[model samples]
Target: MAKDQTTRICCIGAGYVGTCTSAVLAYKNPSVRITVVDTSEAKIGAWRSRSFPISEPCLQEILKQVVERLAFSTDIEAAINAADLIFICVDTPTVTKGTGEGFALDTSAVVACVAKIVEVSTSDKIIVPCGTADQLRKLITQKNTKGLNFEVLSNPEFLAEGTAIHDLLHPDRVIIGAENTPKGSNAAARLVSLYQAWIPSDRIKTTNTWSSELGKLAANAMLAQRISSINSLTAICESVGADIQDISQIVGLDHRIGPHMLQASIGFGGSCFEKDIRCLVYLAESLGFRHIARYWMADLEMNDFQKASQTERITSLLGPLASSKLTIAVLGFSFKAGTTDVRSTPVLTIVRDLVGRGHKVKIFDPKAKKEDIQETLCKANLGRERAIVSLNAMQACDGAHVIAIATAWDEFRTRPGLRRMDWKSIADGMQQPRLMFDGCNVVDAKYLEGLGMKVLELGRKQAML
Candidate 1:
């Protein structure tokens, strides 16, 4: 295929990674015709409508512009037959049973997709896997026989949730892994050319097949490790009465250390970090490196501790949440800002614990859908009177004794150093001793005090922080 030639691309899974990646490809490259196929008819229907399956900012707007170029369908076989390239962006979740339970990646989805491809596809096509599961390569090799030719390429995504569009437009780096042979080089170049339309040539990195798979796991593990390291220090700072902000500044000033992903909060929560780190641990253990596996495993343990400790700290502050009968609110429910994905969110654990403690809870998010929020909490009463989903920030904090700013959303904070709340209204809505817990440090404590709310931040005992 030539550099400027139009290509038919079929993405097997239409999820957070698949949908965003395919949307960007279609928008940036008019030469590229993209079809996203998912097994769930409901998801395909949502994608076809103005309302997206995922609540992402500007997603529906962009979908409207690129609707002609992009197609969402449940017809997997037909989409596959018309494609020159197949992108497998299926979910590789943590294994729950059988061999390597809890740490190994479940590659059954990708394997099943490959089987479907073998049954329908008559021509050879380049298959690029975004998930780094080991079983994919073996399945491809075993399935490859007479009258069948498929090339496996690894192209893992490092896209963050909130800034997905921007990241795709100007990626920090693009990784493509193929064999070092001539055929592999040509296949890799085809993908590089597609990205070269928007990304700089130098930013795209090419490697051998195995290196690419290992690199994907290493990248997520390192990011999770940074969060765990900073969180571990936050505990020390809290006990010593030293501010976490001071520690972060002084420690981050180092030229080698730098300042990125070092923000100390409740913990790191998303689809990738914890799952990928545990995958790394499993890989190490399978290789017989027991010590190495345990070393990296501590990060996940520390993250879980951070969430539990945060809940404990808040319950202790209220003292008998059941008898107090307070209406508490959480500002954000999604794993992070900008996307409506609730997988592995720290706020869910906190919310479940609060409900168990007999505290009335309310919630609101700028972009999160009501369905996703309810699913994560696993409570139907949340939509009812038990813990209502508020319309806005003001409504969420209207009748709560304590407000928890769980996710770091821009609207919840005092922007441009300006207060945006009715102090008297907030004060009158709640019972005695109105408290605010700043989980993500988005709210300004002193500024909230001016608005007639007592703010308590994590990792800081006094107002000095």
Candidate 2:
């Protein structure tokens, strides 16, 4: 199967999925030369320089051992020409406009990648489809391009951004989807061999193409549904004086339901969960299954509601929001901690709303790069005069009339880091009736209340507050 003297591997994208996945492959198989090529020279340079292009743990350590085997470049055609196996790890962002608009997947990059490969290829290469594509269109590309034969195998990545390295090294399961034909099966076997370097044989699953294709979307959809379901219960908890954390603990005890993605927060935000769920909804609607589409779309709708409502909810808590000339402190800017990725970060919606209402928002995130946050703020046309990033945790919360915990960074839980004073100091340094809004429901509200502060937390027993 992949019995070439030296297996050549090329990954077509150097973004989140590409960089992490290709590094793991290179680390596992030292003999196999892996080339990671991206359109962005800056991204390629970042990868080559062995810096954190994306926030992933253990990346530097792994790259140390396999950096020589792995190469990053902007040359796509040359990579395609020399590769026996190519992983199309390009991005498939959710379409934001046009016919499908908000829900459908924008696979323009994947389509364009296929066309380029067809134009350059001289031999049949094992094309492992890690993201998205239709087989019929692939067949058309095959038919049109002379001397271009691509063995398209579906091998989607299931690694989370924060824990990508660990997930790659010790994956719970590995799925390899291929056509039912002999060539497809053989291609799948080659991939299985590559992964078998580290992953247990039992963990690798072989399936038909369609099952593999939908499996990625379905898995993400199910995760989003779980998160939305918990968020939905949060509203009830808030009104009825119940604690979502407590509810989560009680419900999580059920072995069947499991205890993943059950935490109630502002909402789930990342590259995958929301967008992938939208894709599932779009697919259902395209097939005229309107009922099924609505059923699936509900999860995404709940997530959006949770994010959008944060600003208004906080405004309602503080009467005459703008008239009050509120000084707000926001801790955690990234969608989740341990990563600099801020794409679709729920905090964006809240920050925008607050700035629009004339509230001054001071932000602090130990991990989220200030430049990235600034870029996002620039896109939203949020002037630095209103929303600005503070140097440290304490600085952001110093003179704030209200403190909002947006991201669940480890540092947010403690005090001295934020002169968010000791219960004793809080009263003296902070304004009267110091209001704290726990946007993520991550902080200890009861403890904050003990400091003579008025704490409003999400999905918690706050009716009396």
How would you encode candidate 1's per-residue C-alpha lDDT over 147-192 as one tens digit per residue? 6667778898888887887788889899999978776788888888
- Candidate 2 residues 1-465, lDDT tens each? 234333898999988888788889999888899999989998888777766577788888887888788899899999998888988888788887798898888877787777777778877788875555464345546555475556788888888878999989898889888878887777788889899999889999999877888998999889888888898988788778888899998899899998888888888888889888888888899999999999998888898898887776677666654467778888888998778888878898888888888889898888888998888898999999999988887778777888888987766674445434344453345664478888776566667777778888888655333
- Residue 10, model 1: lDDT of 95
- Scored against the true structure, residue 120 in model 2 reaches a CA lDDT of 81
lDDT of 2 at 92: 82
CA lDDT, candidate 2, residue 291: 98
- CA-only RMSD, every prediction: 2.8, 2.5
Candidate 2, residue 271: Cα displacement in angstroms equals 1.3
Q: Considering every candidate listed, which one attains the maximal TM-score?
A: 2
Poorest 10 consecutive residues of model 2 by lDDT? 419-428
| Pairs of colliding residues, candidate 2 | 394-418
lDDT per model, in order?
0.80, 0.81
